[model samples]
Target chain A: MMTLSSLPAVSQAQAPGLPGRAGLGLKHEHFIEVLETSPDIGFFEVHAENYMVAGGPFHHYLGLIREQYPLSLHGVGLSIGGEGRLDRAHLARLSTLIERYQPHSFSEHLAWSSHGPVFLNDLLPLAYDSATLQRVCEHIDQVQSTLKRPMLLENPSTYLQFQRSTLDETDFISEIIRRTGCGLLLDVNNVYVSCINHQRDPQSYLDALPLHAVSEIHLAGFAEDTDSLGDRLLIDDHGAPIDNAVWQLYEKVLAQVGPVPTLIERDNQLPAFSVLLAEAQQAERYLAQVSP
Target chain B: MSLQDDFAAALLAPEQACPDGLFSINGADPASRFAVYRNNVHSSLINALAAAYPVTLQLVGEAFFRAMASLYVQAHPPTSPVMSEYGGALAEFIQGFEPAQSVPYLADIARLERLRVRAYHAADCQALDQQAVLLALQGQADLGTLRLQLQPSLATLNSPYAVVAVWAVHQTEGGLATLNPWHPQGALVLRQGLEVKVFAIDPGSVAFINSLAHGNALGTAVEHALEASTEFDLHQCLTLLISHNTLTHLHLEQKVSP
Candidate 1:
């Protein structure tokens, strides 16, 4: 057997150009397809926790892809909204992964997914109050200190609204970014979905957003459903094609926000890679016009 | 003020549930709205568990797995936000679960599956060579007390059922033959490159590796192996371990005569 230690250290140096382009989430079924063809997309993103293990097919494919393209480590389990101290072991695992992969960007959700020892496994909303805002700011501070890098916190697609919310969603996000010096992962699809679900206007909400802090953009599909009391609701399913309305919103967002590093996310009901490539091509066309 | 804390409290206290009175014009009821969040949480977690314990889920069909997973979640909703690390205590839970008691091997299967998951996520390290290991072992005059360091991803599990056969069949994507539970089997779990691999180990190798893992030196571990089986082959066992990357580190200390 070849001596692995004798070989030169794997050049984990980041690829020069990754930012300001459209990317896609690399899934299992697409790994072989991606490896063979090497799609012309900007970059790829993976859930850090998904690859948090020692050896698995995930790492194998990721390692292969890492050599070719820039990657971002998007975390869904950090639970930045929790009240207690951050989970050190979880942070350590993430640190080790970062040390190995050296991703271009690392991010997590602004919403909480865990409370005490009970993790809901869903990005549940938090009431926009001073206490909760302060808690979230402190958690972001800890995460930045631990990782020694600024992380973009994505806004969640909320289903329910709280009556006692003293602060607006954009304001809360702005406050967190201002206090912690972290960046924002503006999910335009989420903005449209949450605005409809909460019965708010998307443009006004966008107007209030801290556009300068925005580092990345996420565009995904949304699902509309009715509640028990006969009300219309929009859910961020990310399971279908990007709705035409959302695409139009993305156009509006691009016109204002300039060309951010946008991602086309599809978690369920994955289609052919070409189908995704086609969507990305359309995004590229839109980005092409505005980038200059 | 903590939305997560308040929402979590409401989810737990389902009996006293009061709708938040928030409604959209398209007939999306508040109760229905709440249910969507609840379903997403439960289904995602259940699916995550199923992914981690494929063998356990296979033994008990999806229906049973979902039911058991529901109970497991309520009993121990994940402490960490990482769902991959959620089912750490599933083996113990299976041992005591009344409905699954008939299977008997289910708990062991859970143990093996959990080990596989752990081995996958374990920290990456270089395995030591045979020459280095031998030199380290030779330093110890008394082998009984010398504790050998097991690979961080290594795990040993024994089962009354044909766990290796069961796990093997389930891992394959094609049609699989049904497994019989009568024959006893022992398995050693470890990661090779980017995949966690499982292999069957003889009774002697199992005892010897277990002893070495508990910090016994080669001489004493060999004695334990011989006690388990007179025809024990320590050389072959050590070679197997070195080849498989199960023996990552070695430590030698003074042995105590019993």
Candidate 2:
């Protein structure tokens, strides 16, 4: 297995970006509350696809809340890991959104969501072979050049792996960062979920990656089920509170990397704004402890 | 086929076998693991449809809606990544769907709900203010040649069933029993500021608004409405449009002043 240490070290220095604190995924249900209260948060993140519409309440509220909070545009449909070329039209829409908001940070996933013209809407896994690695790097390079900004690539939670894979997941991510010069979003919930499902050590998975390249972090909840063998299966459903085990792994990450910008994402079965804010505050407390 | 080709095919087609080379670290069945992706894709897409068509979901129960939406997802997966833009073909799909025939008006309700979704996200444009509308009406000579530009969010639906009444009843409590779903009705959907409002209008008014939306001049649109119904009231329709801030621009066509 090729280790990250064997590869030539790229500069880990990052340009000034999102503050080293915690943020929450801005939900439409909480737009009015956010505007009225103007909560003290590190920033607010939103799904780029949700705001792709030309104009509407989504844009209207986002424009208002953006004035007060630093915004991160997280994209879910870029298909950065697909075998085919990137979707030009979707890329154009993303460009338009970036131009409009000028968000502090932009991120997409390592998983593929679309095949050809049909979008599956779920973040599907990839075989970490040389061919898949090259395709993913090319796609990331295209996105960076088109948007004229370095994007953060997120790690995905997978239920299955392919026998054809030639590289470890961490090694593939390390090479992609080395090749394309993009930063890592470092979704901690995904780390916990994938590690548990695959029977790997979460700490070892984190240590193998180029931690210096991490620019942001995501913490979310997962739904638990069992596989055909009745072993534990973790689904990255983002429908509940962050698991205690994931939080422990996150603290370990902060201890190593010293507080990257973190986001609390709750996409399904959303609770009140106060509940999400409280979770963000909990992350902030951990971040405060690790602050230099 | 390529890896993604095989994977995507199986994701949408539940009957197909899981793609080759997939394995779980715990030695679990690949097919069961793959079922997670299948369930996510189908349920999420179905949920998007259900979100866009709440009334349609209510008219039919959840189980029926999910089953119908699952078939719709397999038949017509989203072309665009924007989930908001997904399920535009659903109204047309429901029309030919064999099971949906029991609720014959289900397709029209779907159509209205889709229009509301579109209106909610349409481009924002400043509507012609009341003063501008008044000034344009004052120019009697230009009235015949006046062309009214509707808001991008404005849409019309003419249904053989009382789609507007049925939809309106769903907004409140206990009114569904009072609605006569068999009566033909027309609807006008427009965004008043941020809120998308749907109003029940007469069929002739639908014809008039549709004509105006097609860029027909005032005189021509009135004639179209009159042809649709002898009792078509131009004043009432004009009031509805102006009050709802539907007209964005009033243009007077320039011809040789003969």
Candidate 3:
């Protein structure tokens, strides 16, 4: 349940997992397990905020671990689509982390996590209007300029719809990409969750997205819970393993987009490290089918 | 108001409904959908607090702690994206909470737990070497005027109730209830390497550490302790602080390090 430290270095020659497309979310639970097994995975991704500390086991472990595999730092705190301006201090901390480790790719959700000082700690959805689109693009421009790196903005899973929305979700993401020169992290589970919640066809939603701009794919488990009216609400808790429907949706995207860095994220009720690797292996299997 | 601001306000205040111009185009109720955001926000925060203060939750139990945390979150939503800094006001919230008044020591325990959380995430620092400390103080005639640079992660909290004893027993092999008499206690929280630990400290030592924590020199802090308690032991207290690696580096208030 903790990040065990032991990563020294691997051979300069690229390992089987390096430069590959299938990866597992590098959680603390699997740190020791990952080190011991050195599983044949493409890359490992981590939430940037968790490693934002100055120096400790995180940096020590991550330093050696990065040598063995490709790393992608996914951020949950950027709140790019928020109403307020981007937090400069938070941005600086992120930049520091980027400079230190220099992960292969960096990504954040197109959702707001803060209103002024209070951080809601969830990927709250935004109104897909002209104003929000412009604001998000501006924020992206600043982040890219500050970090000196192109970021992949992940699409958020929405449980509710905005009453005064003008732009379609796919159109909004496409516009953000076009305006900011940013890439997309296509989260198949989020597409499944949002589409099922709002009763849109997941295929249509996937088709509308700018698949060419996608650099990474996120597949996670969603909890099928009901809302107040008893209608199903697919909560993206990232608690369980990726489900069958989501896997099929993933395959559909892979069929079109080919292969990218794919991650399996399980944040709560974490199973054994082997279980996650098995899931990651399955994602590899799919990528192999798409490419081979 | 902007749609997001209004939406954020509604989520913060449970009584408030979905913001105006909010809808579910696919026929799902907007209110229900809004509740999803609300639940995500609250449950995530509650989980953060629980993770930071597991001992406190154990002391108060889950159901009661959840209810208390719900009220705490509503009263004080997080002001920053840093989850580590999210629940700083929880100890004070517990102090003001009427239902938790029976376990008056609960707030102090929570405060101790928060200190541990801060220590765990504090910058990794190298502790002061014992030989270096001795060499620095060897020729110094005015030792009392010497200020100490304690580890940034080192902290001391004095409570009217035995907080350290309570925190320790909960972490023991078999968790036992605190049967000790209701006496005042002091705790020294420090990070040894990456792991944060708590030590039960004598009242005089706590006074000395508190003085140093406030930027007082060695002499002044010792005098402050002596005034507070005539039985204050300076040599023993310094030994305690040194042994625990609480004092990382030493400094002279008026001049540079020796």
Which number leads on TM-score? 2
Lowest lDDT 10-residue stretch of candidate 2 chain B: B135-144
- Candidate 3 lDDT by residue in tens digits, B141-241: 88988888788888889899989888888786675743572788888898877678888877788888889889999988998888767888888888777
State the lDDT at A16 in candidate 2.
43
> Cα miss at A152, model 2 (Å)?
0.4
What are the chain B TM-scores of all models? 0.82, 0.97, 0.92
Candidates 1 and 3: which is better by TM-score?
A: 3
User: Candidate 2 docking: what grade?
Assistant: high
* Candidate 1 residue-wise lDDT, A134-184, digit = tens: 989988888878887778889888877776678889999988887887877
What DockQ does each candidate score versus the true complex, computed on alpha carbons?
0.39, 0.89, 0.66
Model 1 ranges with Cα > 4 A deviation: A1-18, A28-36, A54-64, A88-100, A178-180, A270-274, B1-3, B12-29, B128-150, B172-179, B249-258
lDDT of 2 by residue, A169-230 (tens): 99999999999999899999999999998999999999999988888899999999999999
After best superposition, candidate 2 residue B231: deviation in angstroms? 1.2
Q: How well does candidate 2 match the true structure in TM-score terms?
A: 0.97
For each of the candidates, give the backbone clash count: 23, 0, 4
Considering the true interface contacts (CA pairs under 8 Å between chains A and B), give the fraction that model 1 also has.
0.64
Q: Per-prediction TM-score, please? A: 0.85, 0.97, 0.92
Question: What is candidate 3's lDDT per residue for A162-263, written digit by digit as tens?
Answer: 766799999999998888878788899999999988889999998898887777789999898887667777999999989899999999887886766689
- The DockQ score of candidate 1 comes to 0.39
